[model samples]
Target: MDEAIIAKGLYKRYKRVQALRGVTFKVPRGRVFGLLGPNGAGKSTTIKILVGLIKPDKGEALIFGKRAGSTGAKSLLGYAPERFSIGNNWRLIDFLVYVGRLHGLSERLAAERALYLLEWAGLGGYEEEKFGNLSAGMKKRFGLVQALISDPEILILDEPTEHLDAIGRLEVLNRIRELASRGKTILLSTHVLAEADYVVDSFAIMNRGRIIYHGSRLDVQGVVRIVVDKPAEFEKALHRAGLEYSISGNEFIVETSGVEDEKLVLRICLDNNIRVIRYDTSSSISDIFMRIVGAEKR
Candidate 1:
């Protein structure tokens, strides 16, 4: 496969805190890859390293075939940080035009692209709006527009939908999907599992500065949902049987490989005299994510 981004054995430390511990992953060309984890999982640190804002204590990051942080690599990449830093007094169009010019675009072309992108991002008439005056969601939309001003091949977005409302989030997500469809290799970092599920082709789950799971969306495991009266006893039984599961209220989502595994779960319940209130074989991304993260905690 043609890899667009490669993070090989990357490590970083902030004084007493080890932010990233030998983290590694790869994103293929023209695909949407998700770097998923909760806040403080070192997702932001990894992104900073990739964007050349910080150097890793160990390992390396690569964009296409070029070393990450190198001019060659940076030229092909665009980034939107979790927190944006821009002049409060600058107008949206002017800021984007300046960024485009910095990327070597001519004055006229930069201005044209700035206007076009602002319109596409639903900030058309707001081009004259001051950066600080715009609402949080509008600022986020403009941040996205700034990232695309240079029309980069690879985009690294850190929580791109952070402050948007429901409708705004949907619009931004749809835009991301459209970008991937146009063959732009994107690396999206977010804590939202459903957001990743909506657009990412593959994902890596990070927790406590380590990568715990990495797989494609189609690699979703088979799971069975069971609700029983004796929840605590059933949990104990599950532990004795060495079966992995996650609890939410009266429900338990247990992983199963096949029919035999499903039968094993039922057998455990029967052996423990647990009264089954309901049972079904349905699962969701949130369930799977919680299960994986929960197992790591145990």
Candidate 2:
């Protein structure tokens, strides 16, 4: 896949606070890469630099192999900011058309794109509805349509489902996954861990403007745990099989190096006649994310 985005030694500062400190990473073409960070950790700042909305104090950002801010590169991507603020008085369909036209489409083409996106976003009959009258969830759906009207090859979304309810979150996440499966490159920035795990093919964890981890899903598949009673006996069972284990209360975390180790653990437990109260595997993308992203002091 062709490279969709690249950044090197990027830095930004805002009057006493260094928002970004030499951040750098790349997103491959036709994959969803999640940019994850805690609040004020520079997730939004890195996004701003990548989209050319704000200049970086140092280093470079590239989109579609072209430098960010280049006229030739600007049209290849769509952006959805963290906040949703649009013309409240305009009809949903009309607003999308206006956005499309600004991206270089003719009026008729813009209108066509607008209608298509509105319907795709589940706002088919509500196209003629006033934006201000729509509920918060509906407004977000409309905002999504605005971002997608240009049919961009790369999508840069900042907190796309922030502050939404369960249904709304699922709605947006499903749409994001659908877009990626269609071979579009997505650079997703969000503080929501569970949803990002579902949509992203890879991850880049940022902390106060620095890139700490950048890798594929397999990289995060370390040992994870599910707690149950009688962990001591379980620990000894694993020990007999030459597998190491750690413990926290009744919860025992056994490290299964790979698929073979995982199977070995299950077999040993079954053979011991242990009353498998609750057996489960360890290690998940979310576990790795939380551990590294929320590192503590010694």
Candidate 3:
């Protein structure tokens, strides 16, 4: 896959805290890549370095082969930070236009793109509203608009859906999906693993300044839960099949490597003549996230 962004052995330190420790990952072009982790896990720091807001003390960050923080890379990237950094006084349209101009767009082009983005972000009639006067959801939507004003190849969003209502979150997620469909490479940094699972093609989970998990969502190992009429027989069948499994009360929790493994478990129960009562799979990003990060804490 063509890489849209690459971080090689990235290391950063802030006084006593080591924000990043040899972190490295690649975001494939034209896909939604998630940087998922808990608070203070260096998601923001990694994003900051990629967007040129801050420099890494060691290693390198690159955007499409150009060093991150370089003018060429900056032009290809659009970033929306975790916090709202725009001034309160500017009108929504004006603010977006200003951001576009800063990205080297002409005044006429800036206005044109701002108008289109406002509509795209569902902020059409609210263009004249002051930035401070909008609702929390509206502000988040506006932040997204400003980020897209430059028509960048890559969009980096930091906690885009944080603190929003369910409806607002849905709106933002749908917009992200739309952008990805149009071939824009997206880097989504969020602590919300479930939400990230909804949109990401692949993700990297970070904990305490280090990456603990990195893989495509389809390849994520998850547990398959099965309840059969005969617990003893089911356990015996699983053992005979040579599959790693754990017994939980009457349910069998089978560790699955992929979709194929999950299907194989069902086949094993059938072959053993075990009547299946309930078959369910729990492959939530949060499940593995807790397992990995919790292990590191120990």
Name the candidate that leads on lDDT.
3
Q: What residue pairs clash in candidate 1, if any at all?
A: none
Residue 201 displacement (Å), model 2: 1.2
Per-model lDDT: 0.88, 0.82, 0.89
Candidate 1 lDDT by residue in tens digits, 1-298: 4999999999999999999999999999998999998899999999999999999999999999899999998999999998875989998888988889889999899999999999999999998889999888888888888999999999999999887898888888998999999999999999988898789988899998998888776566458899999999998988888887888788898887666778999998888888899998755556668878988879
Task: Give the range where candidate 2 is weakest over 10 consecutive residues by summed lDDT.
Answer: 221-230
Which regions of candidate 2 fall more than 4 Å away from where they truly are? Answer: 226-245, 255-257, 264-277
Error of 2 at 28 (Å): 1.1
lDDT of 3 by residue, 27-84 (tens): 9999899999999999999999999999999999999999999999999998888776
lDDT by residue (tens digit), candidate 2, 86-124: 778998878887778889899999998888888899988
**TM-score of model 1 vs. true structure:** 0.83
Q: Write the number of the candidate with greater TM-score, choosing between 2 and 3.
A: 3
Name the 10 consecutive residues with the lowest summed lDDT in model 1: 282-291
